[model samples]
Target: MSETSKVVLVTGATGGIGSAVCLRLANSGYSLILAARDISKLQAACAALDRPGLPSHRWISVDMSSDASIASFSHELATDGTVLDGVVLMPPQMRPTGDCQPPADMWRQLFQSNFIGPLELLKSAISTMRPDPSQGRGAKIVIISAITSVQALGNYATSNVLRCAWLAQAKTLAFAMGERGIHVNTLSLGGTLTPDYVASIDLRATKAGVTFSERLAEETLNIPLRKYGRPEEVALAVEVLLSPFSDHMTGVNLLHDGGFTRAY
Candidate 1:
């Protein structure tokens, strides 16, 4: 983190929405610092990002589900010695494991993946960002939550229960850091056209006593927009919130669902 470099650390950079956010942020000229447990995928993403005229960036291997990994990442960030401009946190989802339906252990694992892990990552990263506005480095931390947060859906008890916790933490971080001039927000996304979501739908449907077609039809009927959102569509909101365009906002949970969550 050169003092001159506007650093943006994006965790879970190998995931579907995470990857899209990375691409959009890179295009916006922030020197990217990407992290994921999958070094191979990170390498591929990093290689793809080495544009002819883009800012220099780096990728690292770190496990979001483990405190040691988060601690290591935090130290690594501090060594860079520059206050970050923004952080985009997305965690690898822990799906219902084994024989379809979630076992007790599976439920805990899923919660850890969706809500616990990202909160840990956010707290760790926030500690490294310079907190003084006098230094000209106010930061933003954006958490990628989901449309499921507002509604109870299917057999996704893990994601459903944990999403509440995630939103609570977003609200907490917003208040906690508001005095320091840092902005915190959450982006509740609709179903995006990502391989991971396709995989999640099939897996959850099989586990929830629903046929794939039934599940698919149910989702199609719900979205007022009548279609799944593209990953870029969700990523666009993330890029805007983290950019200077949204400097005045904080603690907002902007919903990007295709009008699917009708709790409005």
Candidate 2:
């Protein structure tokens, strides 16, 4: 662990992929700024982390779906004299509710939370990342996208659209942010076996009148790896995007789908 403790914030910190990133960065010696709307869950997650020889974490109540909440959280970070070193944006785990037709509100919330909120966080924290153009050190922004964005999902149209938009947004922001040494990129993922996945399976089971495992198994079959992903595996992808190894990289979208997306 390095003594130079830089602040790294992770949104949706209670989820599978997000929590894995949270733990990975914490173990790597970064002081974390964890955010999620649920205070109890956030606190419990913080307590559960075994920092051992790593830096402590900071938590803020943030609802990415609400612009007001995101703004307040950013403001609080700004006031606390903590500048950002890295950011990992994770969207909420959303599933289709039988209509197979995307709801307008679902699209709205997903777009805001998945794309807009993170963009706002980056914009608000830009000054902190790029203090002086002379000194090339700047913050890094990493987004968690889905492999399904490239491959169409039968019922998850909201994700199909919102995730694509988010990747585009990341590219745009990357080009704009690169000059100051800030790095921006995305990790498009495959199936992850998170608690959220379990919840979605329950819904699928209820809808199909089947057991949860049966529903989950059906969903997992599409993944080329023939299994759901572990959160730590996704975290490793995030780590590479965040590290100095990727300092030259920006405006790039990397896939971590275990060959699920066959088309390059």
Candidate 3:
């Protein structure tokens, strides 16, 4: 890799899609700082992305569900003099998938994880992206929301609502932070073949007393592509937003659902 490689921070980096994005960015020659709630899992992800002769990736334990943790992590980054070129924000991976209304506590926690915590992190560290606006360099932010944000999911009410709110938050931030040279956007995705999606499908199958394949087929049947997206495919879209290709694009919600979303 070149010495001029960019530094990118990827939150929730141990999750299926997050890890995929980390690997893809690493392979593309970007230095990464991986963050998650679990150091063990985050370390494992870093190890997986390690190339013997390349600059090794770094891991930080960050509990995005907690305000203190997010503040502490942001403070650490801010004071360390590390300037981030890009950020990939993956909201909490463990999401409620049933149709039943979640309890008040569940709703609060989901909002914290999916909305408040991330917004706080950005508030604390966004300035570090462009310490001097005159430098003619801006930072990029890609928020990973679900296509459920745009097209409501019958079973995933909490995710649908919370993630949609997050998309709005990103759009709002884009305008607020534009003058600072920070590009903020949201990527609303549909049925990607991540482990979480597969597990959710399996649970639905068990609940319906149908074979997993049957449930899977039913889920994809309405999708125009009749298939789930690969993690790398989504990662590539993230890569695009992080690169110069999206310099002119901000506050936009790009859907990468392989025709799964019914909404425009």
Candidates' lDDT values, in order?
0.77, 0.78, 0.83
Which regions in candidate 2 have their CA more than 4 angstroms from the true location? 1-3, 50-53, 97-106, 131-136, 199-222
Give a tens-digit lDDT track for model 2, residues 154-223: 6666777778888778888888777777788888887777777767679879999999778877876876
* Per-residue lDDT of candidate 3, residues 83-155 (tens digit): 7888898877645568567788988887788788877776665766862457767789999988877877777
After best superposition, candidate 3 residue 81: deviation in angstroms? 1.1
For model 1, how does the per-residue alpha-carbon lDDT over 139-223 read when each residue is reduced to its tens digit?
9888887766788777555667676777888888888888887898888876787897788779878988999778877768968
Q: Which ten residues in a row have the lowest lDDT in candidate 1?
A: 93-102
Q: After superposition, how far is residue 206 of candidate 2 from its true place, in Å?
A: 9.4
How much is 216 displaced in model 1, in angstroms? 6.1
Residue 213 in model 2: lDDT: 79
Worst 10 residues of 2 by lDDT: 127-136
What TM-score, over all chains together, does every model reach? 0.84, 0.85, 0.90
True-structure lDDT of candidate 3: 0.83
The predicted structure with the larger lDDT, 1 or 3, is 3
Q: List the residue pairs that clash in candidate 3.
A: none
Q: For candidate 2, give the lDDT of residue 120.
A: 83
Residue pairs clashing in model 1 are none
Given candidate 1, what's the lDDT at residue 16?
Answer: 84
